[model samples]
Target: MKKSYRIKKDVEFQKVFKQGASFANRQLVIYYLHKNDQPHFRIGLSVSKKVGNAVERNQIKRYIRQAFTELQCEIKNEYDMIIIARKPVKACNYHEVRRSVEHLLFKTKLLNK
Candidate 1:
């Protein structure tokens, strides 16, 4: 994903968390804020150390990012989304992570039909 497509700032993430609507499944929690001026969606990822060691956390983040990359065209274009990995995600593979992400997006009605 491009740097421009990511939500990297602490304040941005907090704004999304505080003002956005959220949805979740067993593996992940998603918080989203609609941004009318945005031309494309931006995503923030959070994978805590409680989920695993540094390597494991990075792997989970990679999988989530890859999932977003693949689903970009199907996602709404004007939202800021934050994805927080749950502890159960440590045991999940890429496919599962992708499915969980897809599920959350669907639940939040952020995916195009």
Candidate 2:
């Protein structure tokens, strides 16, 4: 994942949380807000402490990031995305996590045909 294209600022995360529309599934929650002229789709990931300890949380975040990075090219332009991991995601393997994210993105119409 490219650092330059990631949602690194606190304000960006907060804005998305406050204003973006959300899509929820068993494994993840996706929050998205359209941007007028974004350079690329920027993503933020959140895994709560309720999901696990630091190690488990980091693992979940890593899996989410990896899936997003792999799918970035297929995603459309001018959108900010935030993916929130659920508890089930921690126990899930790579393919499961990938599919969950992909499914949500597809359902959200972020991926072009």
Candidate 3:
């Protein structure tokens, strides 16, 4: 993911956490806030130590970023989103992560038909 498309600051993440709406499945949780001025969506990812070691966590992050990249056109613009990975995600493959992400976006009404 490009730097411009990512939520990199602590304050930004905190803002989304405090003010955004969220949806989740067993694998991932999504926190999103509408940003009317933004021309496109930005995302932040979080994977805890409990999920796995560094290698596994990085792999999960990569899968999530790839999923977002592929789904960019279908996802709504003007939102800041944060994806939090849960323990179960360590057992999932890329396809499963993509599906989980797509499902959460659909549940949050952020995915366009």
User: How well is each residue in 31-62 modelled by candidate 1, as lDDT tens digits?
Assistant: 99999998999999999889999999999999
Q: For each candidate, what TM-score against the reference?
A: 0.98, 0.94, 0.98
- Candidate 2 per-residue lDDT, tens place, 35-97, comes to 988788999888889899998898888888898888878989889999888888878988999
Question: In model 2, which range of ten residues has the least summed lDDT?
Answer: 1-10
lDDT per prediction?
0.95, 0.89, 0.96
TM-score result, candidate 2: 0.94
Q: After superposition, how far is residue 75 of candidate 1 from its true place, in Å?
A: 0.3
Q: Write the per-residue lDDT of candidate 3 for residues 1-113, one digit (tens) a residue.
A: 68899999999999999999998899999999999999999999999999999999999999999999999999999999999999999999999999999999999999988
Q: Scored by Cα lDDT, where does model 2 land?
A: 0.89
What value does the lDDT take at residue 73 in candidate 1?
Answer: 95
Number of the candidate with higher lDDT, 1 or 2? 1
For model 3, name the residue pairs that clash: none
TM-score for candidate 3, residues paired by index: 0.98
